[model samples]
Structure formats: C-alpha cells, structure tokens
Target chain A: MRGYAEDKDAYLKRLRRVEGQIRGLQRMIDEDEYCIDVLTQVGAVTKALQAVSLGLLEDHLEHCVAEALAEGGEVADEKLREANQAIARLVRS
Target chain B: MRGYAEDKDAYLKRLRRVEGQIRGLQRMIDEDEYCIDVLTQVGAVTKALQAVSLGLLEDHLEHCVAEALAEGGEVADEKLREANQAIARLVRS
Candidate 1:
C-alpha cells in the first residue's frame, strides 16, 4: 500500500468535511448571501482544503518517499523525481 | 503578516507551478489527450494542490494559532475555535 494508505480514513473524513463546505457555499450563493460574506466563506473553505493537502503530503514524504529512499537506486531516484514534480506542481498552483 | 508570511514567496511559486499544470491539463483536453492520461494529470494536479494546502496549514498552526495561544484569554479561545472550524471544514472536504 502507498504511504498515505494508513491514514486513508482520516483523509477521507477531511475530504468529506470539505464537500460539506462546498455545499454550504453553494447554498449561500443560492440564498444571495452578501458578497463579502460569501467570499469569506470561500476563503475559509480554501484554507480548510489546504490543511488536508498538507497532511497528505506529509504522509507521502514520511512514508512513501522515505521508504523509497532507503531502498536506493533508480527506483529511489524516480520516487524523488516524482515527489519533486509533485512539489513543483503544487508550488505553481 | 502571518506565520506563512515568511514563506509567502515560496508559496506563490508553488501556486504558480500548479497553475501551469492546470493549463497543461486544459491543453491536454483541448488536444484530445488519451482519457487515462488526462485523468492521471488531473490526479497529479490535485495532489499538487494538496501539498500547497498542507504547507499553508502548517504555517498557520505554527504562527497564527501559536501566537493566539501564547496571548491567552478570549482572543485565544476565538483563535482556537477558528482553527478548529478550519480543520473541520478541511476534514469534511
């Protein structure tokens, strides 16, 4: 299993919460909530999602990446590259 | 300025990379890239965003939340609540 596999339940739970927030956001839009209020909620949701992402990344680094490095060689190199690519994509976003 | 303020440049750079990945994904769709390949890229993008989110959350915890806790009292309570709410939203998502 992947490194994050162990914490999969926690990740799913976090994602579910984010899903709820999105629904709430949609509701606010439908209700014609004040623009700033809606924006504030949007910010809140974004921050929440970010937290989840960070936790997953940490798991990936500690588990998957760490294991791959211990093994060493081409696979390790590939894993490291994959991680860098992931980070690069993340930073760019 | 907040806890993440110190790493703001790094964050922005990461975000920019993600943005590029998104554009690449869009182009892939436009050019009719293989469905599986497109999905793979999408997965990559999601993971990337998650990394950025995690970094931001760490900063928030280490900086804003920590600061509030240090001060104590009503302000601390409010800050803690806000952080919990943020976490709740993230978990749900």
Candidate 2:
C-alpha cells in the first residue's frame, strides 16, 4: 500500500478544495480584481498546496522510508535519496 | 483598470492550466501514485502559481504602484505598504 493510502480521502478533499480556489482565482481575474487582492488569494492557494505536500512527505517518511530503512540494503539507500530529493524540490518550490 | 489588464488573457490561460494541474493531482491520488511523484507534481503546480504571483507583482509595480508613487503623497505610501505586504505574503508562502 502507498504511504498516503490511509489518508487518501483527506488528501483528495484538500486537493478538491484547492481546485475550487483556482477556479475562484480565475473568477477574480475575470472581474478585474486588484492585483494585491489576487496576489493574496494566490498566496492562500500556495500555502494550501504546501500543506498537502508536507502531509504527503510526512506519511512517506513514516511508512515507506521507515520500512525501507528497516530492510537495510540498496533499496533503503535509494529510498533515502528519493526522499531527500523530494524534500529539496519542496524547499525550492 | 487593474495592473494586469493588458495581460488578462495570458493570466487566464495560465490559471486554467493550473486548474488542469489540480485535476491531474486528483487523478494521481485516485490511482494511488507514488508519494515522490505526487510531491514533484505539487511542486510544479506551486511554481506555476508563484509565476502568476510574480507576473501580477511586476505589473502592479510597473503600473499601479508606479502611478501612486509618481503622484507622491499618502496614496503612494499606502501603495508601497500594500505592495510590501503582498511581497511578504509571497515570500512566506
């Protein structure tokens, strides 16, 4: 099972809400909303997406990475590398 | 007119693409995609949103804020504060 399997529903819910926010942003633009107002909304959506990333990262570390580390082999090394890379991507994003 | 008025269509196009990305994310979750892959896609979407924010900020600075600053008064101060606050929000996100 995937690391986020247990919380899949919650993740889906959050993603769907973000989808709505994106749609809202389009609406704001259509209405010629002020740039700062639009930027504020964009900030909110970015934070929500970051939160989802954090949750997924936590679950992956707790389950997938932990399991691989317990196995103690090349797979463990690969998993650790992948996790770190994802983290770097997260920080850079 | 809003600062982004000249590029409204471009902004809308970008936002629609982001909306599509959000849908793609929901699909990945439904299919139980790997955590790292999901995280990578989230980063892509986040970067896309950040690009939009940056575009709006540039337009605001070039047009709205610039206009207020040219006028040179309390309105200019208010615009500067608002722009700075928006920048802080972007950085924090």
Candidate 3:
C-alpha cells in the first residue's frame, strides 16, 4: 500500500482548502485589495501547500522508503536516491 | 492608484491558474497517486503561488514604494519598513 493511502482523505481536504485560498486570492485582486495584503495571503497559501508536501514526504519516508531500506539491496538504494532528489526539488521550488 | 491595479486582470488570471493546480492536486490525492508524485505536484503549486507573490511585491515596490521614497520623509520610511516586513514574511514562508 502507498504511504499516503491511509491518509488520502486528509490530504484531499487540505488540497481543497488550498484551492479555496487560491480563489480568495483572485477575489482579493479583483476587488483591488492592498498589494501587501494579497502578498501576505499568498504567503499563507504557499506555506499551506508546503505543509502538505512535507506531510506526504514524511509518510513516504516512514513507509515506502523504510520498507525498501529493510529489504537491503539495489531497490533500497534506488528508493533512497529518489527520495533525496524529491527533497532537493522541494527545497529548490 | 495601487501598484497592482494596472495588472489586476493578469493577477486574477494567474490566481485562477493556481486555483486549477490546487484542484488538480486534490484529484491526484483522490486517485492515490504515489506519495512522491503528489509531493512533487505540491511543490510545483507552491512555486506558482510564490511567483505570484514575487510579482505583486515587485509591482508594489516599483509604484507604491517608489512614490513614497521619492517624497522622502516619514511616509517614505514607513513604506520602506512595511515593504521590508512583507519581504521577511515571504522569505520565512
């Protein structure tokens, strides 16, 4: 089973919340909200999404990567490498 | 006029796109996409929102802050301080 499968519903809920925030951002712009105000909301949205990613990454490491590491072989190496790359992308983005 | 007022339509358009991305993220989770894959998409969405914030900040500085700095007084100092605080929030986020 996928690491996030158990928490799928939770993840979807968070994504929907983020979607609402994005729409709120549009309304702010349309209504001519202050620039800094919009920026502050955007920062909040960004942090929310970042939280989602971090959660998913944590799950992946706890389950998928953990299982692969326990197996002790090339598969484990590959999984670890993939996780590192994903972490790098998240950091860079 | 607010610095972003001129590009208000563009900003709204971008926010709509970000909204779409957030919805896509929900779809990904509902279908139980791989955790890493979900994380990657989340990172992309985060980057998109960050770009929007950066653009808004740039416009604010170019127009609103520029005008206040040109005036050269307490108003200018207040504007600069506000902008700096906004930037700090963005960086920390």
Who wins the DockQ comparison? Answer: 2
lDDT of 1 at A22: 51
Q: DockQ (C-alpha) of model 2?
A: 0.93
| Best-to-worst ranking by TM-score | 2, 3, 1
Candidate 2 regions off by >4 Å? none
Model 2: per-residue Cα lDDT over A56-83, one tens digit each: 9999999999999999999999999999
Displacement of residue A7 (Cα, Å) in model 1 is 35
Top model number, TM-score: 2
**Chain A TM-score of prediction number 3:** 0.97
Q: What DockQ was computed for model 1?
A: 0.04
DockQ for each candidate?
0.04, 0.93, 0.89
Give candidate 2's whole-model lDDT: 0.96
| TM-score of chain B as predicted in candidate 3 | 0.96
Better of 1 and 3 by lDDT: 3
Q: What does the lDDT come to for candidate 3?
A: 0.89
Best by lDDT: 2
- iRMSD of all candidate structures: 11.3, 0.5, 0.9
